[model samples]
Target: METALEKRYIDFDATGFSNEELLTIYKKLVLPRLIEEKMLILLRQGKITKWFSGWGQEGISVGCAYAMNEEEFILPMHRNLGVFTTRNVPLNRLFSQFQGKENGFTKGRDRSFHFGTIEHKLVGMISHLGPQLGIADGIALAAKVKKEQKTTLVFTGDGGASEGDFHEAVNVASVWDLPVIFAIENNQWGLSTPSREQFNCKQFIDKGIGYGIEGIQVNGNNVLDVIRTVRSIREKMLQDSKPVLLELMTFRMRGHEEASGTKYYPEGLQDEWKKQDPVDNYTLFLKEKGILTDALEKEIHDSIKHDIQKNFDLAQNEPLIPAAIETELNDIYAPFTQHVIAPKGDQKEMRFIDAIQDGLKQSMEKYPDLIIMGQDVAEYGGVFKVTEGFVDLFGKDRVRNTPICESAIVGVGLGLSIAGMKAVVEMQFADFVTCGFNQIVNNLAKLHWRWGENADVVVRMPTGANTAAGPFHSQSNEAWFFHTPGLKIVYPSTPEDAKGLLAAAIEDPNPVLFFEHKYLYRSLKAEVSTDYYTTEIGKARTVRQGTDLTIITYGLGVQWAEEYLDQHSEISAEVIDLRTLLPLDTEAVYAAVKKTGKVLVLHEDCMTGGIGGEIAALIAENCFEHLDAPVKRIASLDTPVPFAVPLEQQFLPKVRIDEAVKGILKY
Candidate 1:
C-alpha cells in the first residue's frame, strides 16, 4: 500500500486548463473575498449580526460551481459564499437576509449565509454542518428518475465527514448510483476543533472507497485543479454508474462565525493560511500565465466593491416583511379559509384497506409524479393486501418493492421526495417504523423546518394493537412523531377519511406521517366519494354532536368511541376525530371542550407520553375555566401490548358506550 502522504495528494498535471479559464477562476475567487470583507465590516458595525467567512476556501467553491452546468444543482453548507456567488445568487438578497430584512429569500427566517435561489438552481445552504450530503443525493436521484441530465454538487467541511448523515448519504448514493458529487472542503477545522480530533484517517477522500465509490484529492487552493477534478467527476456522475468524492484540501482563514474570535487557533496559522489563500494563489497563477494583468485585477476588485454597495443600498431601502406574511401560515397546509369544497354526495361503502388502495390508484392517475413502494407492495400486493394488483395496474416503475431495509427504504424515500417525486413509503407494520426512526425524526420530521419549506416526503405505517401480533408487532408510535416539529401526523378512523387524507398527504408539499390503524383496515366501512376528494391535513372532523362531554380521539380510538356512542343514546358524547396531529387541531379541541365543559382524551398508545397527554395539557392550559369536570384520559396500559387475545384487550383502551356514559354521568 502507498504511504498516507503519497495517497493524500494527487498529481493534477494530467488535467489541463487554458489561461483564460484560470483568469475566470481568479475573478470568481476575488469577488467572494471582497463580498466577505464587506459583510465582515457590516457585522462589526452591528449592521449585520452574523456572518460566516468563506475567505480561504473560495477557490474550491468557485471551481466546483463553474465546472458544473448552469442547470445542475448545488447544495452548499454555511461556508460557501463563493459557490453561491458563482451560481449567480443575487448579492442584494444575500445581504438583506443577513440584515434580517423582509426582502430576504426566507423572509428573515434564515441568515444571509444560508441563502438559496431555486431559479439559479442553487438549492440552498443549511447551517447544520453535514446533512446536506443526503439532500444532494436526493436531488441527484430525482434527476435520474426524471431523466434529467443534471448533476448535483454538495459541499461540506472535513469535520462534517464524522457525522452519521454523511455516511448514510454516501452509502445510499453509491448503492443507488445517484448523479451526485460529494465535495469536501477540508479546511482542517470543525469550528474550534482540529480535524485530527474527529478522525484518524489521513485523507477524508479515502473514506468513500468503503462505500464502493471512487475518491480523489486535490489542492483546493488551486482553482484550476479543483475545476478540472470536479469536471472529470461530473462526466462520470452524469452517466449514473457511481457517485464520486473529491476532497479539496483548503483552510479557514477566519473563525467559525462572526461571534467566534480565533482565540483557539495557533498564533501564525492564520497568517500562514493567508499566504496560501486560494484567491491569492489563483490570482498569481492567472497573472503568471498572462491571462490577468495587475490592471485587470484592480478593475475586478473595484467593480465588486461598487456592486456590493449598490445591493446593500437597495436592501436597506426595501420594506419589511408584510403584515400579511404573519397570516401566511394559514396558507401553508391548505386553503381552508377559501371555503372551497367539492360537492358532497353519498357513495358506496368500502373497507379501510380497499379505500387506501383506491385512493392510491386515484392519486397515481392524477399525479404522474406519484410513486408507491414498500415491502411486498408491488406484485405480492403488500402484507395486508392494501396494495393488491398495484404493480399490474401501474407499471413496475411506479410500484417498487424494496430489500426489507426499513432505514434505507425511508431514507431513499426522503431522497426521492427531495428529487421532487411524491414518494409514498410504507412500513409493513407500525412497529417496523422503529427501523426508520432516525430517518423519520432527524430527516423527514425536521426537513421542512430546518431547510425552510423545501422538504417534501410522505411515510405511511399501519398501526394499532392487533391482539395476536404481540408486543413487537402491536405498537402505536404516532406519539413518537407527534412531538416532532415539521411533520404532519394524520390518523384517520373511517374509510372515507382515510382515502381523503391519504390523497391530501400525497399532494402536500411538506413531509407527512400517515398512520393507518391495522384493526380498522378490514373491519370498518364507510361511504367514500368515488370522485377525487381530499380533507385538509391539520383539520379535525366533528362526527357527533353532544353537549354533555367532548371525546377527542383519533384512529382506532375513534372507532371505539363511535361504538360507545351507538350503544349509549341516553348520554350524548361529542366525538372529534383529530385526523391530523402535528399542527394539532387545537382550535377544534378547545372549541368542543369549551362547549361540552368536559373532555376525554383517548388514543391506542400507552398513557405515558402518548399524544393524549399533549392534548390533555393543551386543554388544561387553555380551557380550564370552561371545564365542568377534570379532564379524563382513556388509553392503553403502560406496557407492551400482549400476545394473548385477552391480555391484548386488557392492554388497549376498550371503552364502550356504557363506560363513556358513566363517565359523563359522573361529570
Candidate 2:
C-alpha cells in the first residue's frame, strides 16, 4: 500500500539512465569526495580551521545541481560543498577560503562552505540553518518580478525542518508560487541529536502539506533516481509557476563538522549506513551497468586526487586579507547624513490613528514604489481600521490583502523591498508578530549587514497593551528588536510624529521596524498639516524645556509623560521623545541630560533588556559627571501581559509625577 509520494520515487528508480549519464554521476561523486578528503586532511594538519563534509550526501547534491541550469541561483547551507564544486567554484579558491586566505571567495571573511561567486550564480551559503529557504524565496520572487528566466534552489537539513524559519519560508513560497525549489537533505541527524528525536512526524515531506505546497521524498543515495525526480519536479514547477519541496532521504557518514566526533551516535548506525554509501553504491551500479570500466574509474579518481592536491597546495600559499578590508567594512554602519529635522515653528497636533493613516498616504504618494500589505488591510481597512480606504484610493496591487500567515506576510514584504519596492507590511496586532519574528530578526535585520546596502525593507507592526485583549493579543516586544542591529526602530506617541517619522522611515534607505501604538490609534486628535512632511530618524524631540529632571520616553510613554507633566507644573520636567531607538539620538539625550542633571527612562516593555537600560547605560557612561542623581527607570513588570483588565492595568508603567518631581528636586 505505497502512497502516491512513495510511488513517484519508486517509479523514478525504474527510469533508465544512459551509460554516459552513469559515468557522469560517478565522476561527480569522485570529484566531490576527493576535494572533501583533501580539505579534511588540511583541517587535521591545522591548515583549514573547519570543515563539514558532504561525504554521504554527494549524490543528491550532484543530481540537483546537474538538473538545474548553471545560471539559475542557489542558496546553499554549510554542507553544500558538492553543489558549489559541481557548479564550478575553483578548488584553489574553495580551499583558500578554508585556510582564511585572500584568494577565498569572501576574501577569507567567511567560512569555506559559506563561499559563493556571482560568476557561478551560487548565492553565498548561510551558516545558520533554514534561513537560506527565505533567501531562496526572495531570489526566486525577484526573478519572477524582473521576468528573468532563472529560478532559485535552496537547501536545508531534516533538523532545520523543526525550526520556525522552515515553515515560514515554505508557506510564503507556496503562496506566491514562486519559481523555487526547497531541497531538504534528510541526513538523519541534527548535530548529536537524531532527526527522530527532533520531530514526532514520520515523514519530513508531510510538513510541506500544511503550507499547501507539493512535496516528495526520494532515495538520495540513488543518483539517477534523485536526478530524474528533481528534473521532473523542477520542470513542473517552472511550467506551473509554483514552489516544490524535495526531501532527499540521505545519511551522514561523517561528523557534524571537523570539530565534532560521532561518539554519541547510536551503536552500529554508522556501520549500517556505510553499506548504503552513495558514492560507493553509485560506482558499483555504474560498473554493473557497463558504464564504467575499472581503468576509467581509476583514472578519474587519480585525476581528481591530483587536482585536489594541487589546489590544496595553492590555497596553503595564498596571502592573508589586508587590514584595509576590515576598516572599509566598518563604514557600512556609519550614521546617516541626510537627517530629517523637526518641523519649524509650532508642532502640529493630530490623533495617533489618523496620524498613522496620514503618514501612509503621504509616504505612498511620495514614493510610487511604496506598497502597503497585510491581512484585511486593503478593503477592510485593517483590523484597527487604520488603513481604511487605502485600497479604494491606491487600488488592489499597492494595498494588498494577504493571507493570515504572518511569516509569509513579512517574508514577502522583505522580498518585495529587496526587489526595489518600498513595502510597509502591517501585522494586525502586536502579539501576532511572534509568528514572523524569525523573518524580522534573522532575514530582514541581518540582510543589510550580510550583503551591505542590498536589502532595505520596512516592517510596520501595531503593538502595545491596554485593550484588555488577553495574553495572546497584548504584548510589548520592542525590546526584542531594539537590541537587534541593522534595523531602524521608531515608535511615535503623537499622530503628527507618527506621520512624520513614518514618512522619514519610508524614504530612508534602511530597514525599519515601525511600531504603531494600538491604544493611541484614535484616543486624541489635533490639526495635522495637509503638506508632505518627514521627521529625523534617530534624533529625539524635546517636548518641554525644564531644568530639574529629564524624562526619556517614546510612543505611549511620551504621552504618559506629557500627561504627568500637565499635573505637575512645579517640577518642570523636560520630556524627550526618542522616536528612533536603534540609531538612538544620543546627542539630544546627552544634551537634555546635561541640562536637567537628573534622568528617568520610561518604556511600555518589560524591564529586562528594555531600551531603558540601554539609554541608562549611555547616560551613565557619557554624562555621568553632569548627573546630580542616579538614573531611574519606569517600565512594565517582567511578565506576560495578562488578560484581566486590572492585571493589565497593573502591568503598565506607573507614572508618579509627584514622587519623581520630589525625588529629582532633592537632588
Candidate 3:
C-alpha cells in the first residue's frame, strides 16, 4: 500500500527533511481527513446541519499551509479543510462553527467554511466560489504596495476555474506581477461534469501560459511531492513577486456533498485513483520509511478523533444564536468622525465635475493609503474626465486603472479594503454595474455583515440620462443598491454636496454606492471650498422652506423641483433633498411630511421598484394620521431611457414633478 511516487522527493533517502518534518506533514494531512469523517457521521445523525466534504483532497491544502509562512494569507474554498486545521485555527472554535454555535467565527450568522479568521490570516469562501480569487489578488496587491514579502495561496475547483472571476483575477494578477499562487484542484468533476467537459484546455496549468505566468501540475495525491513543490515555489515567489498557476491534480473520492452520492458520476471511482488515496497511501508511505508506525498512526487517529468528538458534543449544548440580529446591523459599519464641512476655508467657483475631482484629490491627500481604480480613471481621467489630472497628482499606484471586469473589480475593491486599505471603484456608467451585480451585492455589501469585517470602499456610479447615452449607458440604478442593507447610497445634485459627499463616502468605513448624475456633472456650478471636508451621510438637506406642500426628491428631481417652483413663486412648495438614499434621515422626512400634511416623493429612476416607493411607504406607515393628502410618487416612465433628446426629456421626471406637485396640492 506504500504509495510509489513518479519520482522520489529530493533524494531516495528524503535528503533535505528530518524524521520530525515528515511526521508533522503526515499529521497535518491526517487531521482534517479524520475530522471530516467525524463531521460526515454528524451530518448523517443530524448533529450538524450540513457539510461540504473535503473527503479526498487533503494534500493540496496541507502542502500549501505547511509551506506558507505564518504571515502569508490562505484564501481557501469549501473543500480545503486542511487549510484551517493546518493553519492552527483552534479546534474548539472550528468544531463550534460547524455545529452552529453562537461563538463561532461568524457568531452563527453563517455556516460551513463560509467565514474568515483575519487573526489567523485565513479568509474563507463564499458559496459563489470565484470571487475569492479576486479577493486574494487584492490582498497580494496590498502586500506589494506595503513592500511586504508575502504571497497568497488561493484555491478554486475544476468548476470554479471556468468562472469570469477566475479570468479577471488571474489576468489582473499577471498584469500587475502580484505574488499569488492560483491553485486549482482539478478534482475530475464539478459536482458531476468531468474536467474534460468543464474546460477544453489540455491541463489546468495550461491557463498560466495565456496569462504569461509560470505553470506547474503536481501529483496532488502525493503529499511529499506537494510539500516540496509548494515550499520551493514560495521561495521563488518571494524573490520575483510573480504569480504562478498550480494545478493540483486530484479527485473527489466522495460526492460533491453527503446529500448527493456518486450516482451522478456515471463512471464511479476508477481503481487507479482509489489506490492513490491521499491519506491512506501517505500513511503507508510513512510506515515504510520508519517515519510512522502502527502505534503512532493509532495514537494520531485516536487523539484527533477525541478532540473532534469532544468539541462537537460540547458545541451541541451551546446556546443557539440570539434571534434579534437586527441589533448588530448598526455596529457593522465603522464609525466616522471627520470634518463635515470645510472649517473657515477660502471658497472658489467650480463646476460639479471639478469639485468631485478636487474632492477625490483631497481624499487621497488625507488618506495616503486610499486608492481609486476603474476602466480609464487613471490616464483617461475616466469617461467624464472627473479624474482629469489625477495621474499627475497621485502616482499610477494610487490612481490605478482596471480591466473592464466589473464583478472582479468590485471584489478586488472589497479585497483591498479587507487588507486595511481603502478603495474606490468607478463604474464607467451606472447601467454597466449590472455586469458586476453579484459582486456589489453579495461580496461587497455582505462582507461586513457575514465576516464582521468593515469594508471601506466606495463605488462611484455615473448615472442619469438626457445626454443620449441610451439605455445601456444611462440608468438611475441607485434603487438597486438602496434595497440591499449594509450598503450606503448617496446621490447629490449640487456642486458643494458633490464634493462634500464624495469625501464622506470615501471616509466612511463601509461599502458606499455614490451615484453622480451625468446630466448634473457639468450643468451645475457654484462656489466650492478649497479645503478638505465631508458632508454627513444619511441626512437630508432642506433645499427650501414653504408650507403648502412638501416635495421630496433626490438627483435630477431636486433641480426640476427648484426650477418649477422658481417659475411660480406663489406655489409655496417646500423641497427636501435626500442626498443619502440609505440610512435615510427619517426624522427630517417625517418633520416635512407633518408640517405640510401632504408629500410628493420623486426621483428620475423608473416609478416601478424605485426608491420613491420606499419613501412613500415610509411616510404612509409612520405619518398616516398627520397627512392631509395621500402620499404621491413621481418618477420617470417605466421604460428604457430613450435615445432622442425630446423623448429623454419626457422620460425624465421634470414635467411629472411639476404636475405631481400641482395634483397633490389639489388633493
Top-scoring candidate (TM-score): 3
**Clashing residue pairs in candidate 3, if any?**
none
Off by more than 4 A, model 2: 1-29, 90-92, 100-128, 144-150, 192-213, 263-276, 280-315, 318-350, 362-373, 392-405, 415-422, 451-453, 529-533, 638-650
Across residues 1-667, which tens digit of lDDT does each residue of candidate 3 receive?
2333442232223568788988888889989988887888888889888888877688888888888998898999888899999988888788888877776887777888998988889888888889999889888988888889888889999899889899999999998888999998888898878877788878878778899999999988777788788888889998998999999988887888778777876564654576667877777667778888788788888888888778777777788877776657755556556557653489989988898988998999999889898999988899899887899998888888898888878877887887899998999998899988888888777777787887788999999987888889888888888878788899998999999999999988888999999888988989988888789998899999999999999888888888989999988877999999888999999999999999988888999999989889989999999999999998889999999899998998887766777788897
Q: How many clashes would you count in candidate 2?
A: 3
- TM-score of structure candidate 2: 0.84
Each prediction's TM-score versus the true structure: 0.86, 0.84, 0.96
For each candidate, C-alpha RMSD in Å? Answer: 5.0, 5.5, 2.4
In terms of TM-score, how similar is model 1 to the real structure? Answer: 0.86
Residue 389 of model 3, lDDT score: 89
For residue 275, model 2's alpha carbon misses the true position, in angstroms, by: 5.3
Question: In candidate 2, what are the lDDT values of residues 300-380, reduced to their tens digit?
Answer: 888888888888888777677676866545533424555565454444566788878877897888887777878889889
10 residues in a row with least lDDT, candidate 3: 4-13
In lDDT terms, how accurate is model 3?
A: 0.85
